[model samples]
Target: MNAEGTSTAGATPATVTTIAGSDSGGGAGIQADLHAFAAHGVHGTSVVTALTAQNTRGVTKAEPAGTAMVAAQLDAVLADFDVRAVKTGMLADLDTLALVAEQARKGRLPNLVVDPVMVTTSGDSLFEGDPKQYLHAFADSPTVITPNVIEAQQLSGTVIRDLADARHAAETIARSGPRAVLVKGGHLGPRSTSDLLYVDGRAFTFAAEHVDTANTHGTGCTLAAAIAANLALGLDLVQAIDHAKRYLTRALKAAAGQRLGSGPGPVLHSVPVHSAPEFATDA
Candidate 1:
């Protein structure tokens, strides 16, 4: 059995596979996801979708992995491991996104958390032109999607400037077919940090007082990955999002005084144990 008290002989560790990019800075993308998975006591695996030369300041360069290679990486993991949940980020091109969406539709994957990472908080564009059409395709298959306000706006073609707009965008995207949408309000305004979850024809808002810090480079990736980790551990969707938001808030607090790069810096993705429940169960 593994440390989480799960059997591992005929089965592997309760694994959450992340199909995303690699951040050389070790702040966001695959690195952040892996860190969050480990911290949450879940096994982590990754298929690199792109490689980025980025620091806290911004992405200076990006080279996307070919569609064939991306597909192969996912196949290798799924064939050998029991991936309970999947989270995706930073697919640098439309073709890569399409490939991912196709595989998921063909039942080659499991519970998916799609983080529609369109543009970096630093104002660097991650996807190329007309990426939304591809995002809509992937969003159509996933169990859940986590999109910040800007990405939500781009995906829904509607400005998500407030909570009402967020609801509208969530409704629009839900029409595209995801089971749930979590529109992150991290970029909404400078006051309260809010995340709106639209599921089962209802909207649930998770709000937190904004933590003022420069070390927030990989927050979005971390949140989605944390939620994926919770799902892998057998939590339901609502419980997973609840735990993820609490975990992220604690991470932001821990990172308040730390510094990673010369630029805006990265969050310290560690939180104390008492801050969250040991595990969540549906029953």
Candidate 2:
């Protein structure tokens, strides 16, 4: 049982575990995940993989945590926590990725959501070396990978310039091992955003009009966390992702004028409309 008085044996209120870096800017990474988890009313725990000096402008410097430290953190959390879902983001190096994959392989994790964060919105590279090899190891771990357009291009070895290209890349990346793929179209040109979900040989497209705003930091982290939160709440992958998107849309709209940092700034993770107790009362 947990502090919330919920049992870990059966499906009830989902408890999500986030493995990612720390954002000093409080816009992305573990910060965003925790905020999203709270908004979705899921119990959230985290193991920090790295610490970053970043803001809305861009990531100034990132210091990767020792692999042993990363492993120890995971051990500490899993040793005593009943984590129903796990989401990973911003692993600075290959060793950390391998460690996380190893834990998953050993069945220490569940409902994994892999957000391959390679490049920042400012075009800064987050990984130091070839991450493809390490990322490929996650293909067979029964995880759901959410990669943006640029990440898909890098992972699939193809240029994704349009919707068709995005679909092709999603299919190709899906072949690598993830049970599902969600290719985000935020980088696509103009109009509306179209995020494609590929599962079991079928493609589902979720589209929304672009909300023109500069304070879009941590969008990926929030979306992946939201999905993980929903999974923790007993929703399937499709339902979880759909609810995540809707929640993100509202968050973006609510964060329109609020300025938090000198750079791009962070979105309002707590949107009033979606804060209804009934929707997220579990936590």
Candidate 3:
């Protein structure tokens, strides 16, 4: 299952897959995941479980893909690629969630990063019902679960007002079975952000500067995908998170000056390490 893809120069790049919904806005979901994977120099494959009609403004409509189609996409990817890492987002329904959980149990999902994506950056609910019930299926499965402040609150059943509250919530959510829980601090407050990583009964905090920008559309998906990419590059759990956070910070900062839409735009996935001009290509 560790098959690698060979590039033209005979260099084999790691394969990473995202089982997620499609975002017509080109800012989040499958589009964002693929952009992140490419930025990390990994080959990306995707299984679309839902189709969302959305823009930088907000999601207007979403339709869950048929179970058969979802399963078929999964089968095709798993059969052909030696996927090194996987990230799941917006499972959309119980049936879709169950199918993914089944695959995880069967050892088909390696280095799985489960982003319990329930809401959009624009305050729109992406999935139906409480995500806590759906996420419980992955209790013993994912390598790590990434949830923002709102999602952590939902999973841990607590209100997070400060870093202390964030730590408590991370620990509580980790009890559900993920090897690690990352409670993103993007919604913590108006000051700089601090993410809490809870793993193996210990907690570590990662501080990040708050970029003054409204174009933070695909931050969650980009972070999770970046972590998956780092994992595919053979970094350990903590190292992957640290590197992913740094990558996200750069992307957010680079995206600050761009105006993509009327609402929040996406981070600059193409500029992973440097500013726009430093890394700009003519291709």
Candidate 4:
């Protein structure tokens, strides 16, 4: 293990890019993505999709970058960096989503982990377009799409009340063109959290004891970004997701006792998780 407690043996030093928005609170969006990449020992790059005036309390205002500016950032990053994996968050609207989707289709965004960030943790919608168009535009591009229960319901038209519902939702969403879909169940249960991964017509369940804390802002972005980082580190899709899940669990646990803001804060990304507890243990 390296100094950060992340395994480095046989791991290539690679770059992972996040095409997402900026969170002034430094909790979610590109901030969370970069933190996850650094935690996994991968160099991080970013193409800002939007700018948001948000804090742990909630998002107050958001404005997407112009399509031209988004394109320029993508061009600059893809031109200069051999980014091994890409994770997307908070595309903001259909126009922004379409632009990123074009790059994914062209294979510029590799090992893509799409976190369908439609709303904030505080229940504010960030997307500003037709929901159907937003869903359709994502088809046939991402390697895996990670959606929380709310977003999964939007994508699959299913009400998820349990792991079974989540499984069905994952399968339904997988049919829409992503190679895999993870329906996150963080909001499903009171005592435990489960995530259903549907891939290759099969479903895998990852469950963990719920850490009781309000410091869960940006978890979705963090998990997706960690998946991209693990992929950039050369882990396969399932391995990457598994490792990412473990990493996020650890971060949540570490953040349980601390307070970062006036409202729900973020996971403790700066803490070293290698030996503090352990890495890649069952979640």
Candidate 5:
């Protein structure tokens, strides 16, 4: 403990996998995700589903990898590594989504955290199909799905205006397949940042101070990856989300002071972490 007497600790480092598009910008996508896993003291592996030639400014070009190549990459990593968790981002099309779903169904993707990446945090539209249709494929497993407000709207076909709406939207998406649904409220109006976590039959509201900054480039991916990191550390559902949000708050605050990009910058995940929050366990 530094200023305070409270001591905190991070979990032992373990391998985790990120199945996502390669972001040249290094702010969002796979690059950001790897950084997040390291920040959580977790080793990270990857399976590239797509590659984008873009920067903080915007996406100049994007090309998704073939389903066969994506599958091969997944196979190699899952077979070789003792991956504790797997999180997905930017499965650019139905084919990509279906491939990952196939892996999940085959029990190849463990502790799966699916980030239904339809739109980018930088206002890029990647997928056009209904998210619910794609999600139905994973309904058999108890996966965890994280979607921002707009994404939640796309996946749930429900308007998210307030906490109640967020809850309803999360529940609807949870019904699609995921065991837990986290509807991120980063797109909402200025106020306390909130997320609705709907699992099984209980819903918990997670709220935080909205850091007014443009450095929120990979907030969604980072949060999901962080949660997976916590899960790899063996924290239960509630505890993982709670710890992940706490990490995000500090990261956003730390990144607010950076000037990495002329446009929106990235959260500083490599920075030294301070006191940790108490996490719930599966006692």
Candidate 6:
């Protein structure tokens, strides 16, 4: 990423870009991702894919940006910033997906994290095209894909009910191209929440005590953006995802009872997640 010490936008090059949609409510999508980046001390940039009239209650309407407009934004960001990592969320349609795939092919967005955003937390479909086709566009090595149970099932064409189901789905998704796959079970009916990490022909389980809170509006986007930020900080894939999960768990726990909206609230990112700050120096 243009040398570690290089300047981009007149800042040190720990910059990350989130190519996703905009939430008027500021709980998910570009807003949440930018907040996650700030937690890790990474500079955040966003290319809004769509705009939504949404709040903690639900999404009333979603409007996608034109292909030409999105392309212009992408061009301007890549030209000016030595972006180290990119996190993709709600890509509206195939054309926008194709534009992002093109940049990845050109080696512009190096450390890519794909959070195949097909549906909103309020149960609304965002992308109208073939889900499989949209997902396969991101099937490339040097990319990490985070798919929840439903999304994993859609990508794998399987029904996921247990850990075995998660394994099969993760493996099938891995075939699509990403070297790493995280099959999240946050939607499972049972008590605890567990995420299956599939990497290098193996699976690792990260189980967290479910906070049982409705303030989980932007959990997925937050996790993906945190991973991207850690990667920009020069962490390995496994390490980055591990740190991100830790941050997400604490963030979720911090916002359990606090209501930021009438409906589901957002994770309180303003709280410090790490016990010891990463860049702290001894005086």
Each candidate: RMSD to true structure? 3.6, 5.2, 5.8, 3.0, 3.9, 5.3
The runs of at least 3 residues in candidate 3 whose Cα sits more than 4 Å from the true structure, single-residue gaps closed, are 1-10, 274-283
TM-score, prediction 4: 0.92
Give candidate 3's error at residue 141 in angstroms. Answer: 0.7
Candidate number of the best lDDT? 3
Assess each prediction's global lDDT (C-alpha) against the native: 0.82, 0.80, 0.85, 0.83, 0.79, 0.82
Clashing pairs in 2: 14-232, 56-264, 57-263, 139-177
Q: Write the per-residue lDDT of candidate 3 for residues 1-283, one digit (tens) a residue.
A: 1222112235678899999999999999999999999887789999999999999999999999978999999999999999999999989988889899999999999999999889886788887777787557898889999999999999999999987898888888877778788889898776656788888888877776778988899999999998898898787787777778878988999999999989899999987432122211111
How many clashes (backbone N, Cα, C below 3 Å) per candidate?
Answer: 0, 4, 1, 0, 1, 0
Q: What digit string (tens of lDDT, one per residue) describes model 4 on residues 71-163? A: 999999999989989999999988898899988888888899999888876889888875555458778888899999888888888899987
Candidate 6 local distance difference test against the native: 0.82
Misplaced by over 4 Å in model 4 are: 1-12, 273-283
Candidate no. 2 TM-score? 0.90
The superposed Cα distance between candidate 4 and the true structure at residue 223, in angstroms, equals: 0.4
Q: After superposition, how far is residue 121 of candidate 5 from its true place, in Å?
A: 3.2
TM-score of each: 0.91, 0.90, 0.92, 0.92, 0.91, 0.91
lDDT of 5 by residue, 222-241 (tens): 89988887777677777778
Model 4: lDDT of residue 26:
96
Candidate 3 TM-score over all chains jointly? 0.92
lDDT of 6 by residue, 236-280 (tens): 776677677778888989899897989988998765545222311
User: Model 5 TM-score?
Assistant: 0.91
Question: What value does the lDDT take at residue 210 in candidate 1?
Answer: 78
